[model samples]
Target chain A: MSTATIALLGQPNSGKSTLFNALTGLKQHVGNWPGKTVEKKEGSFARNGVTYDVADLPGSYSMSANSDEEVITRDFITSGKADVVCILADSSQLERSLFMLADYAGIDAPCFLVLNMEDVAKDQGKTVDVALLEKKLGIPVMMFSATDTKAYDQFYFTLERALKEKSHINVSELEKEYEKIIGYNEIKEQIKGGNISGYTPMWLTVKYLENDKVVSAKLKESLPADAASKIESIGLDANGAIATGECKFKWIDELLEGAVNKTKTGVKLGKLDRIYTHRFWGKPAVVLTVILGLLGSFIPALPIMAVASIFDVLKNVIGDALVSVGCPAFVTGLVCDVVIQSFSYIVKMLGFVFGVTLVFGMLEEVGVMARISYVFDNTMGKLGLQGKSVMPFLVSFGCTMGGAAGARVIDNWGQKVLTIALAWAVPCGAAWAIIPMLSTVFFGAGAPLIIVVLLLVMILHMWITAKIFGRTLVKTEDRCGMIMELPPYHKPKWGALFRYVFGRTKDTFFRVVKVVLIVCLIFYILSYGSGVNDTSILYKVGTAIEPVTKIFGLPWQLFIAFVASSVGKEGAVGVISALYAGGSYGEGFMAAMSGAARAANLNELLLANVSRPEALAFIFAITFNLPCVVALAATYQEIHSVKWTAKIAIYYTVGALILACLAYHVGLMIW
Target chain B: MKKLLELLKDGNSRTPEELARELETTRDDVLRQMDFLEHAGVIRKVPFMNESNGCSTCASCSGCEGGCAAECKGCVPQNAKMNMGTMWEVV
Candidate 1:
């Protein structure tokens, strides 16, 4: 009995490991390659009294020296250690998987092809003519599933035959394909018959054209200096690896021209995708979908919002009871105004949070969100950024600070700064919570219209902001096209979607409660002066600023809340709960004393007190305000430019106020 | 493959379907060429997040505040924008 060393080679995920394990089960040893961390596997199997030693080469994309694994695989092949190389390619995608075989063509080694995953190819309506492929390649070709146990009989027969008659892949067709490249023949002639042990001149020339560092170094060392310099000039004109890669792919296509046949299936977009991906209709389709999605969220939110009103009724009952018991006014206000009012608002905010998270999460889970990005990718380009910049903007819908962090993917600093700058205009999660809740309060059944208007305004604001900032931050020359692989739409996993929504809503509940309670407490203190006309310091300051605040259509109280929103959007709600409900403290006290009806619910109180125009203005103001101080810090961290961060903050502030003024005037005209 | 690179030189992003349509080929062909192009260093995949540095930078970062260091659910991953798809750009 003699020993035959057989090496198995393939690209990553070509079922190489499955075949190796099938042949060497329980007899294999795994260790790292010499001086490298890449795993090496060696095993033996005795068949027909001949013991075969098998080396499983590390899987890589190609035989190029692009990585440690590729170098090791090529070195082992060229070292003449293997009697025959069994190259594997995925039959289901021979156009791609055969790339390894194509790259291996010019080597002076005995090899045969194994087209694995034949069952998968058959299921896909493909058939590979093995006899034709074998004749074309001058090698033994087998198409079989490595997972099939009985397939090893044919594999053994092929291996024995491959060993008995040493065969090299027919390179006549491949060399013809390479001859078309501008520099291939010139470089091949310069290095012809050069004293390289394993690589033919054709192989060395292709590697030199590819700028493969190791091969280039070796070739330069072997060839005379004059010949090497001449070869270098010719290789410089080639497109390096891309040109050679084209050659390999083209050659593979030709090799499979007759040997591989498949039923043609043209790519077709789904019905909904047809509308979503339409060039002219895509943006409007996406915009309409988002608007409808926002409206759809309110259905779930309405119930939770109604339940939150219970907290309002509880506020009144607790206050009346505390007052009846002769509780101190300070304790009464703390319990009824700060604590109850803040809890009510936080509960209401959670409803919107849950609704938005569910709607958006479902959209993501079902795959519409990707279409949204596809729709906006061109718009991103117009904004002086790449298509990838749309990702951070989409993230901004959940959190502006996160959007800033997502900007890390953009390699160009100017585009990154501009992306973060534009992302700020998109209202974040907190804004989404507060704005829609406020819209429902002010607009009633027409709240969805307010959301639509806001979305439109948001688009306009981002466009103008990009124009204002893009001049200095991003240059047109820095832009480039991108290739997007849109994922196919599929049924969403309901379990995961609800888990995320419940998780996000629960998170918002805690975060909102903390901010709202703190802001409410502070405002309650500032406005707690014991006077008939509500003449506390906050009252005084608010009245004094009333005229200036009216320009933005915000009352003094709402103006102060707008100011607090810069701290966090949730803080704005706290201010509203304190100021308005604290006014209830005085008004409710007067009503209780006179035996008139106690002040109505907080909703009615707000409706009677703040004009519809003022409410609209306040909503726009807070929605478009600087997201929060944390977001401000995140912006600076991402752009690393205090000057630019401050610039963006100021821009959003002024932009919000302008948008508010416009919305207020529009509201006044409507009413 | 070179034609695909030529199409991208216009600085306008396109989907694989669009590229296939423009190149007058099947989507699989376009994808296979893209794989080759990407490996050859002609194009690169655009990552949406730098997982290593994203959370490490901000200590009080609200996005990662609630022990979601491994995956920030609050601030990022708000939706399926990540599921939107894979993107590659010319290098």
Candidate 2:
């Protein structure tokens, strides 16, 4: 049988392997290239009483020696081991897939182009004229799907013609494009055509200018010292790759100008994208969307909020039954105040958690969150940070620890520290849970209005904080540009979206329960026993700090809860449940003495004990406070500077108090 | 492609659509050029939230163990910014 060797070459996903498999069937052996990890495939097939040997070259983007696969592919084709090369391009996206053909222009190998995936191109409303492309390329070309078992006849026919004619790509047009590059002619003049066995002198010159290390070193070794020094002195421009790449792309576009027809689906932004990406309107539009989404969350939360009342009923039933059995007041207090009250608060907080997660998760699912990131990316640049800094800020919305961790993408230390500092201004998941829950408790139907105001204040807080820390933490010159690919909007996968929401909420429930129960039980025992309200260290310490805390409009109990929030936002809730329900042991004492009615629930207790203005101040306090001790550790872990981490922590704490003070005054005016 | 690089040198951020508009070219053309620039090392992909999965070790060189497809339970909540999509930066 007459045998001929052919190599299949293409970019990744260009259907090279599929064609290789179809051509060779089971007669294939896969092994690594000698001393290289890149896979080497060799096989043979007999057709029409003639044997054809197929070598599948490693798939790569181009002929440049960027990776082992690329080096091997280039070396094999130039080594003249293949009688003909079967170059493949995906017909569906020839604009991109043809890059391999463009880069392969100068190799002295006879080849034919196989426009694979013709079926997919037809599906996308694209049509390629095989005759026209063959004329333009001056090489055999066929358009057929690699998966089509019946299409091999055309492939084999084209291969035979390419072998018989010894056809090579028409490089006159491509060489004219390359000649336009600076120093192309000068470099070509120095390198002889026959010096490199497979690479043409024009190709060597282009690769040398593009700073291909292999090509440069090879030319240096072969050229006389004086000539080599002249070329070396020309130097590698940072834009060398860009300029050479532009030439190849321009040539590809010109070659395919009339050879390929595609439906005109122009890249135009949708109406929503227009507003969401507008230069001035983008920020306001994103801000408004987030506020509206937060308000929408309350709708889902209302049901879960209503469910929390059952805990109050359970608390009364359990408390009264324990009392009827002559159980001690301590046991009743532990069961009613600590266990039931903390769970009631946990359940309420979880409602907001579920609601907020669902709304935000749905936004992310439908691809609107990417727009939010795009909008804020510009803002990040204005803050003397890289666009990527916005990523950490976005993550902070979920958890400050995660945000601090996300800051690792920012390579600059100063910028990273500043990013973490500013990320602290964004409310974390726990703050979202607790803020809306408390807002509804204090403001009722006006909770949405409060959420809107908090979002506005958050924006203001981030700006002012950036101004304060930016000068020292980030340099103006340390900024760089970014390009983003906004994902197309699609229908939300409700199953996945809801699954994530429920999973997050469930996690929050378990995590919050542990923190709240522990914090609640500790504070409860500290305030238990006869007149311990007067004698307990917590009460004395809380009362002693009341004067200092009152400056922020926080009562002693709320102020203590504000302190507890530094450990965790849920700990603040635990403190509130314990302090309000236990109440200087007032409920039990009053029940024993004057038969005064016990507070109906924690809501009634909070309403009786804390004024609206004080409640508002406390909300602002915990909302902006240092997210948690875990976040602090994470910040330290990232920044690796105790000084900066401590500095950020102190700044956030002081800033939170200042915001609280301002919010209290505003609340007093509204009330 | 040259003009695309020049536009990015202004230290501003742009989405692919905006770049396509500014360059007076189709998004596919712009994307093709980006692919070339990326492979040629003229630019680099910005490893963002979706790739890193917002995990703590992601910001470090160690990378996520399973590279974002695997769940990194508890370190970062699942599905955080999973749809933020890809980003690139000029080298």
Docking class of 1: medium
Docking class of 2: medium
Per-residue CA lDDT of model 1 for A161-230, tens digit only, reads 9998898999898899889888788888889947898788888888888889999899889998888888
Give a tens-digit lDDT track for model 2, residues A1-671.
79899999999999889999998999999999999988999999988787999999999999998999999999999999999999999999999999999889989899999999999999989988888888899999999899999998988898899999999999999999888887888778878732778888888887887889998898888888878888877766767877887788888899899988988777677999999989899989998898888888898999999899899889888877887788777778889889998888888999999999889888887899899988888778888888888778877887887788888878889989888998888899999889998999988998899888888899888888889989888887677688899888988889878888888888788889999999999888886545446777888888899899999999988888999999999999988888878747354544532212543677876887789999999999999999999889888989999998898899888888988999999989988
Q: What are the candidates' interface root-mean-square deviations?
A: 2.3, 2.6
lDDT of 1 by residue, B8-63 (tens): 87789888999999999878889889888887777998765533444653323545
Error at B16, model 2, angstroms: 2.0
Best by DockQ: 1
Q: How many steric clashes does model 2 contain?
A: 0
Q: Model 2, A145: alpha-carbon shift in Å?
A: 1.1
